[model samples]
Each structure stands twice: as structure tokens, then as C-alpha cells.
Target: MSWARIMAPLSGGEGDATALAAAVRLAEPFGAEVAGVYTPADVADVMPWMGEGFLGGVQTTALESLKEAAAAGEAKAREAMSHVTYGKNAFVSLQTPVWSGLSAESRLSDVIVFNGDSARGRGPLAEAFQQMVADEQRPVLVARGEFSVGGPIAVAWDGGKEASRAARLALPLLEKASRVVILAAPKASSRTFDPTRLQAYYAARGVTAEIDILPDSGDAAPLLLYAAGKVGAEILVAGAFGHPRLQEFIFGGTTRSLLAAEAPTLFLSH
Candidate 1:
């Protein structure tokens, strides 16, 4: 498996630069195209609030304001993308139906990239991040501080479908890592499984991986994080387990803990 294209959603905010830089780093090794997509606010979404009885002048002014905001955002996104000179790059500006445009772009790409702000639900692209992982079910890379693709990588295994999917989707990346380690805590969960299954799977794909059976702990996130740090892993591959609950996405305990942590880039799939 190979990654041919990477999609990075840019909100023209503080996280845009980090997210774009991470995408470029991931793309360089695979010779993949890095698409910096500018996500703009859809004017149509606000039109309903104007009410049917609103005056024409008021509506026109509101529309103009929205257009101006979008233009400024697009300019900022372009500026952020301009710094990427390492690999193939493209600048994409979403249309009126911004969400649909983003979804389409994500479907066509191999993986989606987001910054720490988006991953922590603290920025303009937070909702977009949730939608991609939960609704779109696409592979996503949450780029944290100083993300590097040349370092060691750790894979969290739970013998679940989600983990299996994540491992499969992350094959291309794992194949390129300096070292790959599989971290599993079978005694922590009710499910009985072996981590060597994953090791064999990776071996079949020509990737050598070491297995680490963590001590039984009530919570698996801490163990996984500790092991990843011990191994000096630059990235942790795991399945994002979450479902939409009304307005928010409720993530599984381990997934939540990992997302809330401050270090190690996350490569996740739902």
C-alpha cells in the first residue's frame, strides 16, 4: 500500500502552519501530493438566520461581509501554503457548501492531516476534524509538536476491529519508520488476544516489528503512552473509537486520553 495524496484542512488560524508542515513531511517520503485545503465559512448556513422578512439591504450587507471574510481567510491560507517547497503541493479553496467540498477532498485523498488545536477541539477546524474521523471514517494524522516521519513508531493493539483497520491503513507509514513496536495490554481488557498476530501481519508486508506486552493496568492509555515514550516513538498509530453524541463526538476512554496528551503525533482511523 502507498499514499499518493495527503489532505490538510487549513482554517487560516494558528494551527494552519503546523498542520501544513506536518502534511509536507509525511508527503515527502512517499512523493505524495500535499493538498492544503482552505475551509471557508459557508454563507448559505447563515442565510436562514436572516429570516424571510429581512430587508434586501441587510441581506446584501451580510453577504458582502461573509465574502470579505472568506477572501481574507483564503489569502491567509495561501500564505501559509506558500512556505511548502519540499514536495508536490496544491492550494484548494472550498466552495459555498464547504463541508461537502472537504468531505469530497478527503475521500479522494489517502489521509487527512490536522494540527494539535484541531485534535484537542480548540480551533476552527475542530468540527472538521471530528467529521472526518467519525462521519467520513478516513485515516487522520494529528500532527503535534515537532512531528518527524523518520523516527520510531508505536502501534497500540487491542485485537479489535478498529485497531486492525488502523494498523492496515498505517502500513505505508510503518514500512518507512526507523523501527516499529507493537504495544498491547491484553490483561487490561476482557478480550483475550495475542499481539504477535499483528507482528506476523506486519512481517507479511515486509515490516519488522517488536512486540511489548505491557503490564496489566486498569487504563491502557497511560501504558501505551509510557511505552511509546520509552521507545522514543515519534508517532503512535491507533484506532480512533468514537461516535457522535448530539453535538459532540464521544470518544472511548483510551482514545480520549491519548488525544488529550501533549506529545507524540497520532495516526488514527475510525
Candidate 2:
């Protein structure tokens, strides 16, 4: 296992459970530890919905609701841990206001998993994924409905340092794959790279992988996904990129699109 530990931020529900399962499956292969960081409800997300943040009864009720949700989420994490076969589990209780605490937690872990929650657009999970995987530059596995850890691995290679690092970080999964394929996008400029070099890099690590160029088409996400489908890859691993201007961050071209991907889980890093 390339990762010594992987963390799943539990939001309580099926998505969290699925993420936990994915993390455990990945961790177990290398005897890595799995930690579920439970953050039930952000006070900001709840307080606003609760209407006019107040004191006394209203405040008490809100606190109680938060506590109940937290407890249930912790229970869910514990239950999921119980079913995991090999990896050891640890629990973390974090109720961060702006998700800063969660972000900090991510820095120490090898990989983080969460649901895409794309329908909500740039919601918390989506933004958090971008923040961790793209902004703070960590490897993250974003899942939606149902996700399984092992299968033919598809890697999106762009020949940049980020993509190279991401491939290196995902070596364990690639090594385990029955088949490995690289999806390289058409280069927009003369400073282009050949995917064959990446394939050779993997060769040194004893992973047999081939490269395929995706259609230089309209939407990046769909095109990559379509190519991945052609290769029958179960999941995608890519390097995420984004930059901050003013107080906001703009996600990398393809990275933003993958956040909305539903069919396959995305394993990404910065």
C-alpha cells in the first residue's frame, strides 16, 4: 500500500458508508489505517436554515439537533468500521464552522474520500473536494451513488508535474489493476508531452499500461469519461489543479468537470 493511512470525512448516510467502504478496501491491501472524520452538520449550514440565529430555546434546539446528527453519524462510522476486514479504524469528531478543520485534517492523511454531490452544484462536498484535491493539493477519491475500489484503472495523463505526481501516488491501485490504460488529452500548445513516457515510467514499476488519446472535444469531463468507458475502466485517477485569485479559487479545466461525474469514482491529487 502506498498510503499509510486514508481518511473519509463522514457526513452520515449511504454516501459516507460507500466512501468508507472504498477507503477500507484501498487501505486493507497495504495494511493501512482508515480514519473516519465525522462532521455531522456545519453550524453555518444549519443555523441559517434554522432561521435567525438566536439564544435560549432556539439555540438549545439547534444544538440538540446537531448533537443527535453527530451521534448518528459516529454510529454509522463505527458500524462501517466493524465490517471492514483488514484495516484498523479510528474516529475523529470535528464540527468545523468553515471546514477549515477538515481541511487541516486532510493534510496529514494519505487519501480522502467523499461523495461528489454534484446535483447541488458547488455545494459543500464539491467545494471541499476541490479544496482538498485541487486547492490544498492532496489525493482525493470522490464517489457518488455506488463505488467499488478495484478494477481496470484509468489514468488521465497530461504530462505535467501534477499528473506525474498523481500517477505516482496512485501506483498501488495501478499495480493491482487487471488492466491499466492512460487517457491523454490533445495538447493545446507546442509544449506537449507524449503519454508513452508515462507508460514507460510505470514499466519501471512493473505496471503494464497503454496510452490512448481522448477526443479533443467540447466538454473535457465527458470526453475523458467516454474514453475511459471505451477502455472499460472502473475508476479514474488524475492530478487536480486550481488557482486562487482574490478570495476565490478557480478549479482546473478537467478537475471541475470530474466533480460532477457520477458513473465512476474519481481518484485525484494535486
Model 2 RMSD in Å is: 4.2
Q: Mark the regions of model 2 whose C-alpha exceeds 4 Å error after superposition.
A: 42-72, 75-87, 95-100, 118-124, 144-150, 187-191, 242-252
Find the 10 residues in a row with the least total lDDT in model 2: 242-251
lDDT of 2 by residue, 71-113 (tens): 7876876776666665388878776564778878888899887
**Model 1, which residues run further than 4 Å from truth?**
53-59, 242-252
Per-residue C-alpha lDDT of model 1 across residues 32-124, encoded as one tens digit per residue: 999999998888788789978765887889889989989999999999999888659999999979999999999999999998878888878
Q: Once all C-alphas are superposed, what RMSD does model 1 give against the true structure?
A: 2.0
TM-score of each: 0.93, 0.78
Provide the global lDDT of candidate 2 against the true structure. 0.72
User: What is the lDDT of every predicted structure here?
Assistant: 0.89, 0.72
TM-score of 2: 0.78
Best by lDDT: 1
Residue 168 alpha-carbon offset, candidate 1, angstroms: 0.6
